[model samples]
Target: MGLNANDRAIASFTMAGHALVHWFETSIPIFLVVWLAEFDVGVALFGIVVALGYAPFGIGALPGGILADRYGTKRLIVLCLGGMSAAFLVLSLATSIYAIAIGLVLWGAAASVYHPAGLALISTGVEERGTVFAWHGIAGNAGIALGPFVAATLLIFLEWSLVAAVLAVPGVIAVLYGLSAEFNPTAAVEEDVDAGPDEALSLSEFVSNSRALFASAFAVIFLIVAVEGLYYRGMLTYLPEILHGLAAIEGLVVPAGLEGIEPADYIYVGLLVVGMGGQYVGGKLTDRIAPARGLLAIFAVLAVLALAFVPVTGMGLAAIAVLCGVFGFFLFAIQPFYQNAVAVYTPADTRGLSYGYTYLGEFGLGSASIAIGGFVLGEWSLTAFFGMIAAVAITGALISVALLAGLDRFIDTDRSVNANADD
Candidate 1:
C-alpha cells in the first residue's frame, strides 16, 4: 500500500536520520587506523580509548529512551544530530589522544539517542512498519558504505583534521532539515490507550517499568542482540587493519598519486554496500516469517561465516572478497529481525524504552568487544580473532533457538487457556 503524506514524511525524516547516525559510526574505524599511526599508541590502549566513546553510545540509550518517552522522539533526535556535529567539530581541533577521546565521547553520547528515538518514531508513527524498516536499513547501509568511502576519498586530498571538520557539515544540514520537517509522531499509535509521550517517570516507576520489560521475552531478545553486538563490534572494529595486512591486498599496487588510498578501505565499503541488499531482504522477511525463526537461521549462517573467514582468506582476494560480501549481507540482515522482535515482544507505551534497552545490549555491553578484539589481535593471531567472534555468533544462534522455543510454548499455553475458558 502507498504511504500517506504523514507516513512518507516520517519515513523520509527517519531515513535521513538513520543514514547520518551510521555515517559517523562507520567512519570511526577509518579514523582508528589514522589514530594508530598518528598517536603511536598501542592497539589495546587505543581500543580502550575508542570504547570510551562507544560505551556511552550504548550506555546512554537507556536515558535517551526515557527522554524520548517523555519529551518526544523528534526533540531527542534533533538534539542527537546537533550534538554529533558539535562533537566532530571538537575532534577537528584535538591535538592529543585525550582530546580525541573527549570528542568521541561527545559523539557517542549524542548519537546514542538516535536508535531509540528514530526506531520508536517509526514503530509508533508509520502505518507500514516493515517497509519503512527496509528503507531505513538500506539508508543506514548507504551511510555505512559511504562513510568510509567518503572519509578515505577525502583523505586523498585533505588532511585528517580538515576531514574531521568537513564531516561536521552534513550533520548541521541534517539538524536544520530535522527542525523544518513535520509529521505526526503518534499517528499509528493514536488508537492505543498509551499513545504519545507521557509524564516523567519517578525513579521507582522507572525501575518498575524496566523490570516489567525485561521479565518478558525481551530479556532473551536483549541477550541475543548483545551477543550479536559482540560479534559485530569485534569483527568490524579491526577489519580494515586486518585486511590491510593481508598478503593479497598488501601485494596489490595503488595507482600513482593515489597512494593515500588503501585498497582495504574500499573493500570494507564494498562489503557494507552489499549489506543494503541484506537489509532489504531481512526487512521484507519479517512480514512473511517469524522474526525469531529468521534470526536463528541468520545467526547460524554467521557462525559458519565467521569460522570460515580466516581459512577463506588464504584462497585469494576474490574468494575473500566474496566471503566478506556474504558476511556483510548476513551481518546487517540480523538488524531488522531483532528490531521487529522488540516491537513484537514489547508494549506500545514503552516502545522507546524497549529500543533503549535493545541498543544498550547491542551497543552498550557489545562495546566491550572493541577492547576485547584489540587485545585479541594484539596478543593472538587473526585465526584467534575470527575464532573468538565465531564463538559469539554461535552463542547468538543458540539464544535465538531458545527464544523461538519460548515463543512457541507461550503461544501453545495461550491457546490452551482460551480453549479452557470457552469450555
Candidate 2:
C-alpha cells in the first residue's frame, strides 16, 4: 500500500525532528573540547563535562518511552524539541562548568523523550515499517553527519556562544513543525496499521501487553548496543585529534587549541556523515535479509575494523573511513530489526513498556558507557581508548552470535510444537 498524504506528512515531521535533535546533540562535543581549554579545565574535568552531556541521552530513555506511551509521541516530541531549544538558549549564557552541565542535562533529558515514542509512532503509523525504519536511520545519520560539519563551519566565524545559539535554531523549527503537524498513523506505513486490534495509543491499559516484548532478541540487541556505546562515545572522542595528526601530511591545519580546527577534521566527521547513505542502503537490505544474519556479519566487520583502526593513517585513514562508514551504517541500521522484532514477538499493548525496559539496557545502561569512556579518557592513553573500544566490539559480536544460536533453537522448537498441534 502507498502512504497517504497524511502519513507522509507525519513521517516527514518525524524525520525533521530527528535531524535537528541529533544535529544539535552531536555537534556540541566537537567544539566543547576546544571550549574547555579556555576555562583551563584539565583532561579529567573535561571528561566529566563531556559525560554530563553525553550520558543523559541514554539515561532519559525509560522516562522518555513512558512519556511517549502515556501522552502521545507527537506531543512528547514537541515538548522535547522545545525543551532542547530552551537548554541551548541557556547554554548561550553558561560561563561555569556547572551552568553548562545544567544546560546539558536539560538538553539530554528533553532529547531523550523523542526516540522511543517517535520510533514507536513510526512502527504504528507506517504501512511499510521497514522503510520507515530505513528513513528513520537516514534522518538520524543526517543529524549525525551534519552536526560536526555545522559545528566546525560555524566555529570559523561565530564565537562558541553564538554557535550554541545557532544550534538552537533548528530546534525551534522542529518544535514549530512538530506542533503544527497533525499525526496520521499512516505516515510511517503504507499499509493498514490502523486496522490492528491493539493499535490504540492507550498507555494505561498497556501493562499486560508489554511483557512478551522482553524477548531474548532484545536482550541480544542491548548487549550489542552496550558494546557500540562504548566504542562510539569513547573512540569517536578522538576522531578530530586523530585526523588532525594524520592530516598534517595532507596539509590540513589542525585546531590550534580550539580555534584552528581544519577542514579535514570536518571532512573526517563527514565520512561518518556519508554513513547515512550507507545506512539508508543498509536499512533497505535489512528488509530483504534476515536481521540475524545481517547484524552478525556487520558486527564481525566492526570488530576487525576497530582493531585495524590503530595502524590506519594517511590514505590508510581513507580505508579506515570507509570501514567506519560501514560500521556506523550497520551498527545503527540494524535498529529497526530489533524494533520490529519486538513488535512482531510481543503483544501490542505492552510495546511501550517493552520499549521502555528493553531500552534500559540498550539506552539506559547504554548511557553508562559514556561514563566509562570518560573514565578511560581520564585514566588512559589514546591506545588504551582504542583497545577498550575494540574489546567492546568483540564482546558485542560474540554476544550477538550466542543470541542468534539460542534464537535458532527457540524458533525450531516453536515450529516443531506447532507442527504436532496441526497433526
Candidate 3:
C-alpha cells in the first residue's frame, strides 16, 4: 500500500535522522586511523578511547527511551541531532587525545537517542512498519557506507579537523528539517487503542514498567541484540586496518591523483554498500516470515562468515571482496529482524522503552567488543580476532533458536491468558 501524507512525513524525517546518526557513528573508525598516527597510542588503548563514545551512544538509550516516552520523539530526536553536530564541532577543535575522548563522549551521549526515538516513531506512527523499516535500514546503511567514504575522501583534501567540521554540517541541516516536519507520533497505535499523550512516570512506575518488559520474550531479544553488537562493533572497528594489512588489498592499483586514498577503505565502503541490500531484504522478510526464523538463518551465516574471513584474505582480491560483501550483507540483515521482534513482543505503549533497551544491548554492552577486538588484534593474530567474532555469532544463532522455540510458546500462552482475562 502506498503511504499517506503522515507516513511519508514520518518516513522522511526518520530516514534523515537514521542516516545522520550513522554518518557520525561510522565516520569515527575512519578517524581512528588518524588518531593512532597523530596521538602515537597503541591499538589497545585507542580502542578503549573509542569505546568511551560508543558506550554512551548505546548506554544512553535507556534514558533516551524514557525521555522519548515522556517528552515525545520529535523533541528528543531534535536534541539528538543538535547534540551530535555540536560534538563533532568539538572534535574539530580538539588538540589532544583527552580532548578527543571528551568529544566522543559528547557525541555518543547525543547520538544515542536517535535509534530509540526514530525507531519508536516509526513503530508507533507509520502505517506500513515493515516497508518503512526497510527504507530506514537502507538509509542507515547509506550513512554507514558514505560516512567513511566521505571522511576518507575529504581527509585527502582537507585536514581531519576540517573534515570533522564539515561532517557536522549535515546534522545541523537535519536538525533544521526535524524542527519543521510535523506528524502524529502515535497515529498507528491510536487506531487500535486510545494512546493518549504520554505522561511522565514516577521512579517506581518506571521500575515496574521495565521489569514487566524484561519478564517477556524481549529479554531474549535483548541478548541477541547484545551479541549482534559485539560482532558488529568488534569486526567493523578495525576492519579497515585489518584489510590494509592484507597483501591482496595493499597490492591493488589506485587511479592516479587519488593515491592518498587506501584501497582497503574502498573495500570497506563497498561492503557497507552491499549491506543496504541486506537491510532491505531483511526488512521485507519481516512482513512475510517470522523474524525469529530469519534471524536464526542470518546469525548462522554470520558465524560462518566470521570463521571464514581470515581464510578469505589469503585468496585473491576478488575473492576477498566477494566474501566481505556477503559478510556485510548478513551482518546488517539481522538488524530489522531484531527490530521487528521488539515491536512484536512488546506493548505499543512502551515502544520507546523497548527500543531503548534494544539499543542499550546493541550499543552499550556491544561497546566492549571495541576494547576486546583491539587487544586481540594487538597481542594475537587476525585468526584470534575473528575466532572471537565467530564465537559471538554462534552465541546469537543459539539464542535465536531458543527464542523461536521458547518465545513462540510463551507468546501463545500469554495471549490465551490475556484473552481469558478479558472474557
Clashing pairs in 3: none
RMSD of 1: 3.9
Ranking by lDDT: 3, 1, 2
The lDDT values for all models are 0.84, 0.65, 0.85
lDDT of 1 by residue, 1-423 (tens): 989998899999999888989899988998888888899788888888899989899999989888887899999998999999999999999889999999999999999999988987987789877678768877888888888889988978888899998988999999999999999998887887364477767799888777777666667778888998898888888898888788888888889988877888888999989888888788778778787899999999999998898788776889889999999999988887887776676643454577789889999999999998898888888899899998898888888988778753553222111111111
lDDT for predicted candidate 2 compared with the true structure: 0.65
Q: Give the CA lDDT, 0 to 100, for residue 133 in model 1.
A: 70
- Candidate 3, which ten residues in sequence have the lowest lDDT sum? 414-423
TM-scores for candidates 1 onward, in order:
0.91, 0.82, 0.91
Candidate 2, run of 10 with poorest lDDT: 414-423
> Which segments of candidate 3 are over 4 A away from where they belong?
128-131, 187-198, 347-349, 407-423
Candidate 2: deviation at residue 198, Å? 16
Q: Candidate 2 on 1-423: residue-level lDDT in tens?
A: 776666687679788888877787678767665565667665566666666776677778777776665566778888988998899888888888888888888887788777777777876676655555557667887887788888887777778878888888888987878777875653544454444433454555454344334332444555556665666566565556445556433554456665555555565576666666556666567557655666667667766766666666535545656655665565555555554444443333344465566555554465555566656656875566667777776776676677667763453222111111111
- Candidate 3: tens digits of C-alpha lDDT, residues 1-423: 899889999999999999999999999998988888888778888888899999999999988877887888899999999999999999999999899999999999999988888887887888887678767877888889899999988988989999999999999999999999989888887866454447766799878778777766777878988999999999888998888889997887879987788778788888989888888788778777786898899989999998898789898999998999998888888887887776677643454567788889999999999998888888898999999999999899899999878765664224112211111
For model 2, state the Cα shift of residue 73 in Å: 2.1
